[model samples]
Target: MNPRRTTRSSSTAKAPHRHPRHPHNPAGRGTGRLLAAVVAATACLGVYAVPAHAAPAATGTEPVVSRGVTIPAFYNPPARLPAADGALVRTEPLTLGLRLPGLDGRPIPGTATRLMYKSTDAGGLPVAVTGAYVEPSAAWKGGGPRPLVALASGTMGQGDQCAPSLALEHPLTIGNKTLSVGYDNLAVYRFLAAGAAVVVTDYAGLGSTDRLHTYVNRVDEGHALLDAARAAHRVAGASITEGSRVGLYGYSQGGGASAAAAELQPSYAPDVNLAGTYAGAPPADLTEVMKGIDGSALAGALGWSINGFAQTDPSLRAVVDAHINATGKAALADTSTMCVGDAILGYGFTNSKKWTADGKPIADIIAAEPKLQAVLAAQRIGRLKPAAPVRLATGIQDDIVGHKQARQLAVDWCRKGADVTYKAVILPNLGDKLLTNHLAPLLTDQGSAVSWLTDRLSGKPVTSNCWTMPVQP
Candidate 1:
C-alpha cells in the first residue's frame, strides 16, 4: 500500500487562466502612444478597441474571496456562533494581493486568495471561517470539487509567519537556496489531480488575527479542520454528501494536530464525514517529546512548544516571562518570523543560552517554572479514542518525536477498541533523517491510506487490523 518513491507528475493541473496585461499597471504617455498604434492597427483589421478603463468580464479565472472582513485584533467573540446553514455560499472575487494578515496576526505579503466555508459554533449560530488560500501557481483548475487534503503542518519554532503558506506561495527559487525545497504543495497537487478538494488550515491563530496558534490544543485543531471543510465546500460550490470522505494528513506538529482532530471529530464536529486520517510521527506524549528533543538536532522543536503553550495558557507565559532572561525574550520574538532552517541554524546547536542564566540548561529552567510545567502537561494526547478510522505510520529510527511514542499511541487506541491500522517500518540505515524516515511510510503506503479514503467517499464499509499488534520492542 505504500508508494515506492515520491515523484512529481508532468501533466498535473495548472492554475486558472488570466489576462495577459497586468491589471494594476499604469497607462503612461509612451504606453498611450503604443496603445494608439495598436488601436489603429485593430481598426484597420475591422476590430473594435476596448477602453483602457473598461472592466474585464468575469472568466471564472478570479479567486473567490471570503465574505467576512479580516478579524480585527480587538474584536471579541459574540455569545453565539453565526448562522452558516445555507445551500452554498460564495464570497466576493479578489485578485491576488500581498501584505495580507494571516491567521497568526502577522502580515504575510504574498499572493493570497480567500474563501468562505460554512459552520456553526457551539451556540448554533451560522458561522463561517475565512480561509486565505495561497499557492505558487495561478493556472490551477477553477471548477469542480477537488480532493480536500487538510495539512497538519509541523511545528515551526517561531509563530505564524513560519507557516507553510510562505513557502507554498513565495518559494526560494534562486541560487543555493533554490536547491532547497520550499513549500510542499505536493499533497495539494496530488489530491487536486485526483479530483479532490484541498484545504490547508492556518490553524486558529496562525493566519488569523488571533494572538496564539494554540499549538497542540485539541479543540482549536478540531475546529480548524471541521470549519475549513465547511468553508471549502461552500466557496467551491462543492458538495459534501453523506458519503463524502475526508482525510487528515500531518507530521510532527501537524501530526499532533491530525491525531487531535481524529480524536475530537466525533464530539466536536459530529457531522464531519472523516473517512480516515494519516498521522505520521506524532508526539502522542508531549512530555517525552520535550525531554527527548531538548538539546539534539531536533532541539529547535522546543521553541515551538514554548511559544504554543505560552500563547494558549496565560499561566504558562507568566512562568516563561519570569524565568527567561532578556536574551531569551529577544530570541522568542525573533523566532516568530524565522523558518525551520533559521531556527535550527540559530538555536539548534546552541542550548537555551538566551532563556537561561548561570549556564543552566533550558529544560531545567522550564522545569523550575511551575506554571510552564502545567502548560506542558496540558498538551498531552491520550485516554481518548479517535472516532474515525486511522492509519498511523512511524519510522523506527525517528529521533524528533520518537517511534516508541507513536507505537505506544497506537497501542493505546487499540486497547480502547478503536479501529487502528498501524505500520512500523525498519529504516535503520536512515538514522535520524527526520523527513524521509517519518514521511516514507505515509507516502509509500498510499494504497492503504489514500485508497481507504477513496472508499470512504464511496460509502464502502471500512475494515481494519486493529486487533493485531507487532511484537514489542
Candidate 2:
C-alpha cells in the first residue's frame, strides 16, 4: 500500500526572503547593535530570542544560530525501523536550565518554567526524541496516577513551527494561530483540572532531528504519542510514579493521527495503559477527502497530502514532481510556514490556476493519476479495532471533510464490534456558513469530547449517552 500521501515539504531550498512581519527601525544605523542589546535583555528576562542570522537549516543536520540555540533537522529513518524492545530509556525532571536540540538538531534554548520533558527510543541507545510537558494544576487532587492526555496536532507543515512549546509560548508570532489556539491543550487543561497529566507530542520531524514529519503515518504517530507519555513521566517527577490512565485527543489532521495511535497502541506500546480516545472530524477516508476538497478554498490541504504520501511512495512523488511546475513546487515548499491567507495566496490563486490551465480541473488531474489515487486510498482509517474505548464526533455541516465520512467511520467501527461513541450535531444559526461548515462540527464535538475524556480520567465508567441520531445525508 502506498503510504507517501502525507509527506512534508523538503526544507533544502532557501526560502525566498520576505520582510519581517514586525516593524524594523528605518534608521538601520544601530539596528543590529540594538537588536543585540535587546537579545541580551530578553535573555536576562528568560525570553526566547530569534537568532539574528537564523535561517531555515538544510536537511539532515542541525543549524546553529546563536550562543545556545539551533534549528533542528528532520528525521528521515531508513526503511527498516529498529526493533522496539530493549531500547535505551531514561527520565529526568524538566528544568529551566535544560536544553534539547531543535528539529534541525540545533540546541534550542528551553525553559524549565514551562516544564519541558524528554525521552529516548530504546535499543540500548541514546534516545533522541524530546517533548514539552505541562502538569495539571492543584485543582486536580487525585491521589493515584493522574489521567494522561496526549495531543497529536494537525498539519503545521514546517517542522520548526510545529513545536508545541513555540505554539504555546509564542502564539501570536506563528502564521496559523490555530496551532496556538490551545484547542489541544484546552482538552489537556480540562483533563488536568480533573487530575490528569497532559503530554503533547511534537511529532517526529516537527521537534526532533527528523527531516519530515510523517504527517498521518500510523506507525510513526502511534510511536510519538506513546513516547511522549514516557517523556511526561520523566518531566513531572516521580510523584506520578504509577502509570497514569491514558487518553488521546485530536482534530482534523490530528484526528487522523490520534485514531491511528489508538489502533496501533495495543501492539506498539502495549505497556502504556490507554483508557480511551476522542477523535473529531478525522479524515478517515483520505482519498475521498482529497477529491472533495481539490481546487476548493481548502485546496491547500492537497499540498500536505501530496508531500506526506510522497515520502513513502516514489511513484506518488514522481507524479507530483512531474505535474507541478517550478512555481508550484516553490509554493508547496512555502506552504508549511503559511497560514490560511498564505494558502489562498500560494495555492488557491497561483498553483490551482496553473494546474487547471488546460480547461481541466485540479481534481481531474489528481484523479487521472493512478499512483496518487492509490496512495490516498491507502491512508483511510476505520480499518482496525482500537484496544480502548473510542469516541468519534463530527459536524453535520462539515463541508471541508464531508460529514458522511465521519458517520461512515462510526458505522464501520461499530460493525467491527468496537465500542464507538459517535455524535453528529446540526450547527444551528449557521445557515450555509463556510466558516461554520467545517469547524462547527469540530468545535461542538471538541466540547463534548473534552467533557467525556474528563469523566473517563476521573474513573467514571464509559458510556454512550453522547451519541445522537444518525445524520441524514
Q: Which one is best on TM-score?
A: 2
> In model 1, which range of ten residues has the least summed lDDT?
1-10
Q: Write model 2 residue lDDT over 1-473, tens digit each, in one string.
A: 12211223333222222313322323233323332332343343233434434455566544522111233333222333434431223333343222345565433332222322333321222224445565544344543455677777665444344455444444322222212122343454455446565677766555444344445655556667777765555553423554677778887777777887787777667877778888888878876676556644446666655555565455565677667765455555555444342343334422254543354555677678776666656666778778888888777777667678877877777777777788666676453313346655665566678878766666677765323435443
* Per-residue lDDT over 1-473 for candidate 1, one digit per residue giving the tens place of the 0 to 100 score: 00111111222201111112212212233333432432343232122121222232233322111111112221112234445532223343323212345565534322334544444432243443344343222122322223355666665433333334433433331121111122334454454445555666656545332233455665566566666765555553343334456777776677787887888788766766677787777888876676667554445556555665665554566666666776666555544433454444444534565466556776676577676666556566656888877878776777667788888888988889888878776655443422335445545554555555555544456666766676634
Error of 1 at 422 (Å): 0.4
**The best candidate in terms of lDDT:** 2
Write down the lDDT of every candidate, Cα atoms only. 0.51, 0.54
lDDT of 2: 0.54
TM-score of 2: 0.72
Model 2 segments beyond 4 Å from truth? 1-130, 139-144, 174-183, 236-238, 337-353, 356-359, 429-435, 465-473
